[model samples]
Target: MQEFKEREKQEQTISSPLSESLYENLRRIRTVFQTSHDVVIRELRIGEDKNIPIVIVYTDGLASSQSVSGFILDALLVHTPKVEGVHNPEKLFELMSTSILAGGEVKPLSDFEKLYLAVLAGETVVLLDGCAKALMVSTRGWKDRGVQEPTVQTVIRGPREAFSESLRTNTALVRRRVKDENLHCEQQAIGRITKTDIAVMYIEGIANEKIVKELFERLERIDTDGILESGYIEEFIQDSYLTPFPLTYNTERPDVVAGGLLEGRVAILVDGTPFALLVPVLFGQFFQSAEDYYQRSMIATAIRLLRYVCFFIALLAPSLYIAATTFHQEMLPTQLLISLASQREGIPFPAFVEALIMELTFEILREAGIRMPRPMGQAISIVGALVVGQAAVEAGFVSAAMVIVVSITAISTFVFPSYEMAIPIRVLRFLMMLLAASFGLFGITMGLLGMVLHLCSLRSFGAPYMAPFSPIRLAGQKDMIFRLPHWSLRKRPAMISKENPVRDATPAPAPPRPEGEQS
Candidate 1:
């Protein structure tokens, strides 16, 4: 036991040296990974007469093989002449500084920090013997997913390009949309083990500095082992972890990110993930899409109202049906009530039990449909619906009306523009169903009241979740449920623009026609 404990302690105490001799550290790394085939060390003899040996090291897949072979290796071997009895790090760096390509730079190998950073960025490091300097070649090329339309948030008429996994590419995309000089991008590497790159972007003049500072402070406090996705960072920085509602909004479109930046919001882009997270996000923001402002105000407002209505219908339709059938039969038409009772007569389970079973089955099928391949997804959904609805109803497991109600509810949930916002509604739907099953309409009213209370109390980045509506900002109501004309909306969202309220100049009236033929 003592020997094992000592061994465990030794293993746990293992740490990498931040400032050790370059050759010694390289030797240690080589010793640790002995017999590993991926680690390649290429020895280059420079200065034809002197034959100074330089070692170029890189990982296989992480670094570009073609660029290294064509540009770096050939440049060092053929272009660089052998030097005689030269061992100065500065002199060697100076020589290679002029030898390499435009983007590549040579520095001291003793600067191990920069060396590691270059390696992580897919560059090959060249180390010369007796010299403490290294030359880092920019050969950073790897397989990345092509820029395509975002699958989650598809629009009819808008920019189709979406962010890729590469953080540089994502930043470039956003930069292309916003040419403003005030747009700032600050980067930090998080995750104790993963060391994932995270970039925080916002407009310097538009975004609140206090909020940006708070976001940075919160992110710096995270001490996790890995952050493979943006969701991990979202949960880490959120004010309330237990709340079902999302405090941050996520998007793949650069235009959406740019729009949020212009509205004084911050965006967090994680490396190796296409989803970029937006901060200070409100409930209403999820319902409004970029395409909303692109179309006519009247059409946009109508569509927005329809989405809000569908949200409620999706959450409470099936539950309301169950409540009415089980305890509030008087509310329904007498003939319709009689028909429902006759259909449910042969079913073994109560309305609640039948509803729960159907809902659970539907949820399972939905999950399966999403996980299946694209070609087979539609087939699976169709067959699953037939099996769960028609066949099950015919077998007397549930009534036909229950199937119809549940199907409509399922379809309505998809009307939501944001998936993050839709999750809470799905969860609340189950709770509402439970309440309705217990006490009918009264239970649903109580559930709804509780939900409203919770939403009113919720805050995103210290801003109210249900803003303009609950706070009774009548002036801001023009863009709440209904979008007014662009000229009419002269101010930004009050919650996000408490300091700079005015957005644009007042509209000027048209000049009078002096001598026109028609008045």
Candidate 2:
């Protein structure tokens, strides 16, 4: 922490305009970049006499070598000698910017802060002998993971391309999908030291102005040393920090971001991370997937409803089993009760302790599977669970029924389309189990009510977290738990696109009228 403050102070002290003297400028540059072996400073002489002094400063391996050799160096050394009136430093700088370095994107930079930003961002900076301003040319060419298939959010029918680590590449992917003049991408530098680039994207007229303004205000208020991923920005800008539920949605797919922008939601794309963040997320949004739109409406609706059912099963399965066996034994059938009693005759722990043991074991296996190598992960999780559960059942540690309940709950948790939403469910399941252990069915009911009330009270960028359910918007319901036919979804969700509510106007399809029937 103290090092960060010292670095900040050093940067502040050097934030001044560049000098016209070439030697003095070189001294200051060397002072700032002392001991940085990768900082390449190439001195060159331009013009007919070959005495016009200039220095090229860039970081090796960041700025493309081919571009520097072919376009910049060749232009200054070979092409400028034939031109006339090149002795004056101001005229030389103008000629080089306008006619010499014609192949590259060049910008005039005056202050040291701007110069350092351009150079560190993989661009070449040229300082003339007697000119106050320097030329910054874009030549970034670092190794990157080219566009690859989605890993976490895999979809069978949607586009196979996903966002890459490069900010420009990610933006271009979205641009390719949403080709509209109103698709606005505003860029800003976040992180005091990292200077990580972030783009705030939304449609101009379709997005709510208030939401956009608020988002900008929140981003501007963030003060940090470094932003490693979109998650950092999400944490800094989220409405509440106490809740486990994620207020912002993140995805690696560009189609998801493009879809969000069309719905008037803002997207934040951070550099050095593939995941992009969508703001003002709702509870229902996590249940819907990109495949929901690709498939037929009825099938999508059925799948979406199944996800909601799975959500409850994942949340309440263990708690219900604990409650039934410990407090409400009469709820079970007589025959089943006898079998369960026979199985638990020799067990030492009570129902709650038994369930907690199995739950913790399963959770440990799940995390191990994720952290281990891919080939061993699946094998370890599957084989370990089967062996441990069987041994425990045979040794009178837990009943077979408990193993079945835990397995079902684990499977249901994997059914969620958004993993962020599933995480909160996993956490709440433990709380629900505790409630059921203490108060049985009544405690479970009270927990449900409290969870629903909390969801209703939560807000994502001032939009209701449980929108269209707590607020009960009829228009938004068409695409909530049940995705209606495409033609029926003619308007965007409330508060998202109030500026331009209507999205689609096409009516439902019908067979063409046969042979001129009389009206």
Candidate 3:
């Protein structure tokens, strides 16, 4: 069985050069695409006697009809002179490629493998009679959702444009922002069946050479049949998969990607996904937002600190409440303790079970909201949560205080700048609650310590996941937990840009002083 599977893989990868006979090539291609109704093949004559046969092939919907008709067909049928020399195979091939084909991108293909790949990728292929090589012209114009405002990483004071599914468009968006000679976007294909295009973008000098090489090697090692999203690549290439914390950060905003590139982090963009993956991400990076750079340093710092606070609230709010009410009631003020006791007077379940029920209900509502139709999803989730919580409280199944704690925790989860970062927090929240339920505050403290130890041990493409904090790098602290002024962030993250850390060379800007003022 293994041998048969190996043979199948070998046959799939085998490549054969095209024959000089036009009908022979057509027969093979037709056989391969016999069941595919959208495969288009048009035969035409282009000589004085109209005896020379040529064929143009492309996918019907994937290739642009306008480009095929105007650029390729018109150039061949009307522009090319119907002369005697056109009958000669070599002469005809040279003339068509050098002059007749009006398409800006035209390349010669000698193998059936490359020809099939090109045609499938929405490029028009021209095969001339008695010519072994075929010309692949760029005519890709499939339908796509154009750049829209970021839905996931929306910013109040930054560029509103987000990446689309098209890989070329996504690269173009990043290029428009980071128009530097040092910026490089190299393309490669992954997945045997899907042949999904992957673009690795980074600034040449600023990016660490070791990290870039390691990333490329890891991508090359991926031997999957299909890669439909950036998440697939993230999973395959990430340094550690055992932890709940995300090793790679994904964002839909091009500005965010461009900023990561400028900071010496490599961006992995999958062809069909709007979210691009940025590698070597640190724990602190998730708390930082694109808007942080747009706002004044003081305001940005405050908001960033708030996000950190929210992170803890999301991860520990329910757990702390359970621990305090169940085992540490003495720690609370007398008035607060009495109020909590009153709220839980008729509650049938323990603190842990009560919190668990409320948290699970909220998760259900949140998932329902996302899966339902967008127009009504938000409404259903909001209204359903309110009604359910009110009914539960009235029936004495859960206290109003429990509902408030769960609500605040849910809100805090949304505070993370990167949605991927919030996922682990949500998962860990349940575990933390369980710990609190079992051993009160001691369990919660142990869980926190374990999470910190796990985070410190984790790595993202060889860079410490808890960088500048675990290792205590003073250089990276400028942008961690606080939004320092742009001028203050003169160097890139040491682990990411080890080759060349100096990112900014300009002197700090200063306003002009009054003429009467003296130094």
Candidate 4:
């Protein structure tokens, strides 16, 4: 069996090393990227009579061609100055890196794994004829989306700029907003094949050290073959995978992420996706928006209250209808009850069946509206509204009251400021409907209790998920469910920002007294 194994072909291990022989290293690199046509390895001779053999390796589309030509290739080949005397190839590498290279960024690499990573991350690598160390040149330039208005989590009053797919651009967006020297970004390359870039951002003194340490440990534990987007890392590192509620908040708006960082939350940014994930996400956070801080405190507070009301309405509207119509008719007003009964006169379905049908149909329509082409998506909405609102009732398939309930639930769901929060609520809404259908109002109450318990039991990066509500931390309630004036906000969240708790100085602001004679 051992002899047979020796005869069989083996895969190239990542531990493979470069050799002093120029041809040997070239053969190894080519063998590893055998089928990849995008790999470009250019060989040239330079230095002191153009006798030195050097090779530059980079991916064709990933590295900027203009940079390679203008900064690297021209400097090494055409404009290279002649040295007085020749030396060992190792010394030649030193001379070329220090004296000959004109690239903006240059670093030396001795390990093959790091060299490979640098090249794959859109950099250029230079190898000498008789040297083991390679020079990694920063030539990253690829066509990516420019900073544009955020499609999701948009704000009407705040800055319109949004994060792009590139990791550096996204981090820069946050940096531009915060402009604090204490803001730090730690990077890690995840995934075995994809090697996606992940940046952990937090305020150095404000962010909880325990949470940052735990976050790094969890990220290091991920052993996946590939991570395509932020959602991939999100699922791998979240508190609980079984719970329906999201333990992390994700957004495409950089201002929102910067605000979260200021509040002592850590932000995780993944390569190739615009959305950045924030940890220690509280239940009240989903109802808050970046626009809240831009507007007057009173207006923001009223809107925030409306959002909380809408959340309950979306979560319990269908279930309440099912329970009241199926088991407890006395809870509803008689006039409303008579109107609903009159609408359900010809419908043969029970309250539970009717709710389930309408809710499921609306979900299907919602999916269709989002998945279809943009022009067709709008058409899907029109068709869905007509079919669900008028056609279904006229066809005697569902009662008008049932359609109205489902419509209200769907509209209320849109009131949530964050779609990630709405996702769990959407799935839980169906579960709540089922419980109410089975046990009426008691079952609904039991479902609500279980949800609260689950939320209380959950934690986000070692901090409470239902913070300021379950444990009743009064200090953290300044901005919960209402917007206090920024000057009145005197402290950071005690749960997360333990090190430097005070956010503002003493002597809170007050309305100025009119000019009067003072004693």
Using lDDT as the measure, which candidate wins? 2
Each candidate: what lDDT? Answer: 0.81, 0.91, 0.91, 0.87
Error of 1 at 111 (Å): 5.1
Error of 1 at 127 (Å): 2.0
Give the C-alpha lDDT of model 1. Answer: 0.81
- TM-score, each model? 0.90, 0.97, 0.96, 0.95
Tens-digit lDDT track of model 4 for 339-409: 98998898988988988888888888889999999999989987877766788899888998888888989
Error of 3 at 151 (Å): 1.2
After the best TM-score superposition of candidate 1, give how far the Cα of residue 374 lies from its true spot, in angstroms: 2.4
- Model 3 alpha-carbon drift over 4 Å, by segment: 1-14
Q: Write the per-residue lDDT of candidate 3 for residues 1-519, one digit (tens) a residue.
A: 999997676456437788899999888788778899899989998766777788999999899999999999888888778667545788878888888898969889999888888989999999987989999999999999999898888888999899999999999999998998999989998998899999999999888898999999999999999999998998999897798888899999998898898888999999999999998899999999999999999999999999999999999999999999989999999999999999999899999999999999999999999999997999999999999999999999999999999999999999888888888899999999999999999999999999999999999988888889989998888899887888889888887777778778878999999899998
Give candidates' CA RMSD values in order.
3.1, 1.9, 2.1, 2.2
lDDT of each residue in 53-170, candidate 2, tens digit only: 8899998988988888877898888876554555578887888898888546998999889888888889999999889999998889888998999999998898999999999999
lDDT of 1 by residue, 1-519 (tens): 999997665344334332324466466446544676776777656676635666777777778898888777777777765545546756766777675433444444445555665676677877765555566777777889868888888899888999999988999999998998988999988876578899999988688888898999999899989899999999998888868999999998899999888778899999999999998988888888888888889999999999999899988997899899889889999999999989998899998899899989998888888899977987898898988699989999999999998998988888888988888888898899999999999999999999999989888887788888778788778887898888888877778755466667779457878895597
lDDT of 3 at 178: 91
Q: Give per-candidate clash totals.
A: 12, 0, 0, 0
* Sequence-dependent TM-score of model 3: 0.96
Q: Can you rank all candidates by lDDT, best first?
A: 2, 3, 4, 1
Better of 3 and 4 by TM-score: 3
